[model samples]
Target: MKYDLIATSAMGLESIVAKEVRELGYECEVENSRITFKGDELAIARSNMWLRTADRVKIKAGEFKAYTFDELFEKTKAIPWEQFLPENAEFPVSGKSQKSKLFSVSDCQAIVKKAIVERLRSHYKKTSWFEENGPLFKVEVSLVKDVATLTIDTSGSGLHKRGYRVDQGEAPLKETLAAALVMLTNWTPERPFSDPFCGSGTIAIEAALIGQNIAPGFNREFVSESWDWIPSSVWDQARAEAEDLAKYDQPLDIVGSDIDHRMVKISEENAFEAGLGDLVSFKQMRVQDFNPKKDYGVIVSNPPYGERLGDRKAVEQMYKEMGKVLVPFDTWSVYIMTSNENFEKLYGKPATKKRKLFNGFIRTDYYQYWGKRPPRDNR
Candidate 1:
């Protein structure tokens, strides 16, 4: 039951996702936005249930080059569809084409769907139309520079949907991206963690999860759970492993604060929804009022970049205030995500390092200011 598994990530988080995959005991190949590895059913369950930064976990069915519709059909049909899909499986084909001869996405979808139906019909010896009333198997055919890759979606909703966040702010960050931001920081459970712009408390909650080593998808259900080919015992074993590994007794000093009282309440509600209310705290406060009580702490914030009209001046002033208060804490590492090009000028200092990351479609820079490392004995 070895399968080629691919974990898709955000535009710039391939390395982090690949690191996570390797940590999960799988050797992975890092591509632009996907990490491919050889795995089995247990790997599928473990990947969907644990990869905090991946968007989706898919099983790569096949890959080939296609120049025309006939070639597409034949190449697609050559795949052993019967090995994956059952007779009554509700498989839907989605397609996207880029710089390829098959420029028509809808046409490619239709042709692929027809070819899969032909293959299934021949395998099952069914003359009537497929009922498609059984388990779901979502399929995608992506064409990049005339090379086609076909995959089956194992994660129903994106992994960012951790089934939490009953409420959110107008510009809340994604759960996956928040986790990535926390992972990028030099933070540990023994140190204090804070997010000044705690929209929906995503970063703080993700930190709490990381601190406790809890599986991100432990409380969520995935689409592949309904597939009959994967035994329930496999999922149970994965869940059992997750439950056994979680350090629930580990205390975390994590906090999230926001200027808006409404957002503060929303953050608290979302944190509780994620089962992290006891481990993390949320409050209403402005970024200027933030003061860390612990040395060698970490601050990761996703402040408003003033992408909207007339908010640029306010955001700039906020950045200046962030520099005024947090920068002077030489023992605290600070990380900020913003799209402003003049962030260093506004923040009053150049960053130790900067990384280019995409927050959805907005191009942004992650400004990192390294702080003094704690003494070995103190650490």
Candidate 2:
């Protein structure tokens, strides 16, 4: 059976996620931070396992207008929840509200839960409480202007939890955002790639995965794997497709470096954990000292923006050093994501283009400096 699915992404990455969904052979509608599509069980399995920039793969169960509490309960109950949830399903409802009559999120959550329980209880003919010892069905109720949209989370953990981050620095970049940083650049598998602020090597590791066309979820599992409706054979075929498409033997020129030796060690461990230790290199090197000999290389970094106390002076100095050394490499493009508004002045060069992105709660700008095109044979 085909189900309506939505892939949630970061604010500025809706188009990117939509492009990926289209690449997966699905027509998608892109909204503020969500991409909606229709697919079957294999679509569910492949989306949960392949979408690199999405936060979560959710099933859009139902949507309708709800003004009163009674109306909310009736409308929610009207949805065919039993079509997805089994007799022994353990469903927990979460909620959020905005510009709606039901301003109380907890109240909305409770009402939805009760309505679902009532419907399920009647369908299953259970006189007692649900045992709650079964596969998990995470339900979410989001309200906007009295219109409620219900969905079930297929991804238990956020997609950024690719199951390979053995360790991370204090301010590590999210894996989904890291992959977006790479996808936004012109860096292909043949082009050299480096991350100067590779705190946990997330950027480099994601690049390696993309370089070899490996599925991001290849090393992880999703919550829907336990749902009986989606058979093991569906997952098996998805894995088999991933295995066949992966470029395990492909060569990647990727490196990650950090001034902190501890972070360097952590980066190495994380890369090894991601099963790309042999394909990528990590080292203890300052951003100012990184000297690239190859032309047409791509440099992506999530540098310090001096948000924390006592980091302003040092971060400014590093920015100056980067400006002095890197801006002259006309043949190599540079991309930096930072909250520092004075980055252009400190870097002594204006970016060719800039795009706004949010790193968690911090608003940052992605600075792009496109380099000269490589020779025909070199490309």
lDDT of each: 0.94, 0.94
Model 1 poorest ten-residue lDDT run: 370-379
What lDDT score goes with residue 194 in model 1?
A: 90
TM-score for each predicted model, relative to the true structure: 0.99, 0.98
lDDT by residue for model 1 over 139-204, one digit each (tens)? 999999999999999999999999988998878799999999999988989999999899889999
Q: What value does the lDDT take at residue 346 in candidate 1? A: 98
Residue pairs in candidate 1 whose N, alpha carbon or C atoms collide under 3 angstroms: none
C-alpha positional error of residue 55 in candidate 2 after TM-score superposition, expressed in Å: 0.1
